[model samples]
Each structure stands twice: as C-alpha cells, then as structure tokens.
Target: MTQQNPLPQEDQQVTLISVRDGNISVTSARALVVKAHKIALKIDTALSEPPAWTDEQSLTMIYTHGERVMRLRGVLREQVDTDRITVEPVGEVKEGDRRDYRRADVDARVYARSAGTQSPTEARAAQVALQLAPTSNAFIPQVVNISGSGLGFTAHEVFSAGELIDLRLVLDQPAAALVNVIGQVVRAVRGEGDALNSYAVRFAELSEADQDIIVYTVFSNHFAAEGLSDALDDFDE
Candidate 1:
C-alpha cells in the first residue's frame, strides 16, 4: 500500500527498536530525512553501544507528530556515515489511532520541582519534601507547549533524563486553573540564550479528574486558536 499520510518532518523525534535472538534494544533518535519509502536517521554513537546491528536486521521505528503516532517497519540498509543510517520500509507506513487529547501550543507558567541528584535515597527524600511543601523551592519555568500525555518547557536548571518531577501548570487567561501532576523527564536539550534547557516530560500516574482538566484545557485552547470551534460543532451535528 502507498503512504496515506504526509512524510514526517525532518528532525522529528523517533524511537528505534532492534530485536536479535530474543534480546531487544531501543534508543531515542532523530530523523534526518523522511521519504516516501525510506528514512535516514541521525545515529549519535557507534553501533556497538546499542548492541551491533547486522546487515538486513529488522527494525521498528515509532514517531509522534502533534498527536499522531506513526509506526514504520523496515530493514536496515547501508550506513551513510558514522552518524547516519538508512532504512527502507518493508510495507506501507501504519498510522496509529488518533489521540483523544491533542497537543496545544500555549504560553503559560510551569512550576516544577526537580527530583534532585541521581542518588535514589536523596531523590526520594526530595520528592517527599516537595510533596510536603509543594511550592517551597520550585522552579518557575516557561511552558513551551503541552498535551494530555506530556509537555515541553524551558528551564533555567538542567534536569537529567529519567528524573522525576512535580509540575503545576498555571493557566491565567481564557481558562484559569492550577493543574498539578507528576511526570518523568524523557529528554533534555540545550535551549537558546544563557543557561536555558528545554525538557520534554511524560506524565506519570494521574487521577481521572486531573486528566480530564488537562485534556479539556488543551482542546479548548487548540480549537480557539485554530478557529476550529465552528468546524467542530458542524462535525458534531
């Protein structure tokens, strides 16, 4: 089957998985080029780091854009460079089901408290302290965007990958509410200007009520900004 959706944009984040002899390995990488039937990925390290890749090894890649998840299966091809690898799709690109809550771009304040150093004991203690005194030593970061599942924001402090965090999303206008949730850091990249780091986080366990509020806020803002409220209403009819 031919591709039904547009090609993924360059530099989109992707998770690559390789399985060999019952052992599986996964890595978070970026797409260098997305084509009709192939994709080039920017490899950050030698093949040995994530275990060696043999010729024609079957690989699976999952990527998300906005709210859509795409799953592509292909066989590894020639290595373009020490930092690049190519793969040719085995079949048509499979688009996952649409997310119930779409991501929305919003300028808001995010109050975050890092779980602190890698020491598990220290991290747990810090987490408990924060829970006891929520706003005592929080970092007020600027939220770049958010969705029901996760969010991205710029913070002055660096947050290590896999760190746990407590977040309070503060929306001030149109709809005002303080939504508190816990999340884990997925990735962190340096941001422009002095000392700013961009962090992507995936929400951890959340109560049903909190989940509903986040979904409602994101959808509301997205529709208002896109002027899609009327279109949505027409569709509902």
Candidate 2:
C-alpha cells in the first residue's frame, strides 16, 4: 500500500492507528469494526508500557454492551487478506493549537542531574530524552542550536505542536543520585521521513528539590566531585 503524510506543517497533530487483522479497518478516515474468525485476542489493561514499535501488540477497546473490551494487536498480513493488520495514518489532531505554545522560544536555562554529577550539556541531553518518552526509542535529540532563551533539536516522533508531557531526568554517579524535572512538549515533526521527525520542547517548571540537585551538580563539577564545593571552598585547612 502507499503511505502518505496528511499534515501540512511541523508539530501538527497526527495519529497512526494499527489495527489487528480482521478486527478493525479504516478507509479514508472512517473506521469499520470487523470480525476475526482466525485470531483470538485477550484484553490486557495492565501493561504499563505499550508494546515496542516492532511488536505486534494489541490495544484494548470497550465494545458494545455486556461483552468486555477486546485487545487488538498489530496487523499481521497484507491489507487485502489474511491475519496481519495495517497502520493507518489519521491527519490533523485537535489536541492543541498555536496559542498553547507557552514557552517555545523562551530563554530559560535547562540542566540535568544524574547520580549527582552536573554538566549543563549532559543535563540538557537527559532532559530531552526524558521528555520524548516512548518515542525517543532509537533516536536521540542532538542539540543543533541553543540560545539564551530556547534551543532546538532533531526530534524522533511526530508530536503535536503545543502538546504537554511530563519528564523524569535521572542523575546517578558513584557518589550521588537523583531524578528531577518535568517538561512540556513544544513541537515535533516527521520531516523527510519517519526517522527524521525532529522534536522541540522547552523547560516549563522545576521543583525546589530539582533546583537544589542542579546546584549540587554544578558545585560537584566545579569542585572535582566534591559536594557543595563551590559554596564551601573558603574553609581553612
């Protein structure tokens, strides 16, 4: 079958639906429920992480009346026949709009704290990975440009512009450890190909504890791995 991108611009809301063989079918933005005579599906609601990108996994959906929702896995066969399913791309998600972009280009410093070491670059990298959750699977965001207020990177997922997401940055070293910060998704795209969809997100808020950890990391780096080194180096021998 032919694949096409239905979005007009970057960060536009887009959705891809992969349905189980003979379970549900979509044609031109309309979904049809089908009956599968050969496949047996079991609904699983407890999976914390959805199946990996390659895995033929099924999502549970509530059906009509007394029957429980069924779990539908990935497509197993060709679109015309058999056991496999297909992933249909739906364009124009309504999740967010341009006005929802609160800090897309704000000049705010972003940092990281892992196991207690502090490096602005490393922290920032960790922040990017954490915010891109599930989508940051194989691709890593490389900071192509940075500014006093905002930065930009190559994103791996087609994130809707102005979407919001929580992040958990981990800092762990031989001497210290911590995870901090939450971020909001600013923009994302699938430019050129699925592999090149760059995402751009900005730091929105940091908790007091996270702020302390960042300060501690900076001090450790400045003081040769010594905690609070920058704040206490004046002491006499």
Candidate 3:
C-alpha cells in the first residue's frame, strides 16, 4: 500500500504566548529556540505528487536527551484563517527511521515573527546555534539538508513550537563571524528508531551586513561546492 503524506489544508501560523522556564506559550509572534535532541521531520507528499503545494504538518516530533524521552506540545495557527492546531503529548518521541516515511521535498514559505522584517533575499545557509536567554540550553544542530529558503538539521532537546530564541551562526569560513539572528522553529520531526532528530527552521530577522555575509558565505559556498563536486564526479566517471 502506498503511504499518504500529511499536508495542512492552509498556511499555519503558530504563536508562543507564554513560557515558564523552558516551556512556552504562543500569544505573540516571536523567535523560536530549538530544544529537540532528535528531530526527523519529513514532507509527506500524499496530498500531491511531487507536491505542488507548500504547507506541511510537522506530523511527528520526538524529544530525547541521551536515552530518556521528553514529552512536549505545540500550536499551529493558520495565517489565512483563525483556526488553531494543537498537538499534545505528540505521539511517541523517539529515534529516526530510514523507511518509516517518504522524504518529500518541502518548499514552504515559513516566516518568523520579529519586531522587524528581513527580506528573503537575505536568506542564506549557515550553521546556526541557539539557546533561550533565560535558560542555559543550547541547540547545536547538524544541518543534514538545506534549500534556498529553508534548512533541515538535527537536535535532541524538547522545545515548544513558536518559542522565541536568540540565534548565533557560524558564518562561512575564513571570516566566520558569529552573526546574531532571530528565527523560529517552524517544524520538527522524530520517529520510533531513527538516529537523529530533524528540524525545519525559518529566519525572521537579521542585519543587512550579516545577510550579505550569509548569502556569500553560506548560500554561495553550498551551491559552488555542489557544482564542483558534480563536475569532479563526472570527470571521474
């Protein structure tokens, strides 16, 4: 039987209204800090082949630090409507799986709430690390995959969706300045036996200089490396 991909009917907008320590509430638009240690969010395209649509549900999320499981909750609010989505005790928060679901391409327009707006032209690929100002939890992630506007990485700490956060990124090497940024934990995923947790993050705001640096350092290098690697592979063949 063919598996069905999970898709949202409309654009979802989540808000972190409050937080007591590590836990948070979605009452206003704010930056989100990632806390999940093992994330495995995948885009299931059961709604459309090659999925012409963009919205996705972080259908699965698991939070584990070392061997212990952490239960969590989140809210998904629609941008086009007043409907709100809440996921509680989010199923089973566990490891990732290789064949549990199809990895559909996600090209959604995810935005983070901030006092200011940063253009998508400022979007770039960079190794970002985050933590809540009040807490000492650090969200160190491994960027397993990325796109022009989105990023996929892994972490194991449990963070409520829509939580606010301060981000520091390791910009492209050589001049790898630790640039500050504000973003949200748009989506998260985890499975029964998967190795690493996966997350999809969207940037909310950044400085112009930092944005240029990111574009040149992160986005340019990624593609340039891919092109070079492909050429070398072709040469080898």
Model number with the top TM-score: 1
lDDT of 2 by residue, 16-85 (tens): 2223432221111112333332222221212111222233333222111111111122332223222223
Worst 10 residues of 2 by lDDT: 62-71
CA lDDT, candidate 3, residue 132? 32
The digit string of per-residue lDDT tens for model 1 on 1-237 reads 854754556776455656666545555456788887778888534211334677688876655544455666788896766556888877766774444346888756677777546454555455456543333345363545887688888777677889877666665423455666667889989877676788899876444445544554564465557654333321111
As a TM-score, model 1 comes out at 0.48
Task: List candidate 3 stretches off by more than 4 Å.
Answer: 1-141, 144-149, 172-175, 191-194, 228-237
The predictions' CA RMSDs to the true structure, in order, are 17.9, 22.3, 20.3
Evaluate residue 61 in candidate 1 and report its C-alpha lDDT on the 0 to 100 scale.
67
Whole-model alpha-carbon lDDT for candidate 1: 0.62
Question: Model 2 Cα displacement at 129 (Å)?
Answer: 20
Task: State residue 111's C-alpha deviation in candidate 2, in Å.
Answer: 16
Better of 1 and 3 by lDDT: 1
Which candidate, 1 or 3, would have the higher TM-score against the true structure?
1
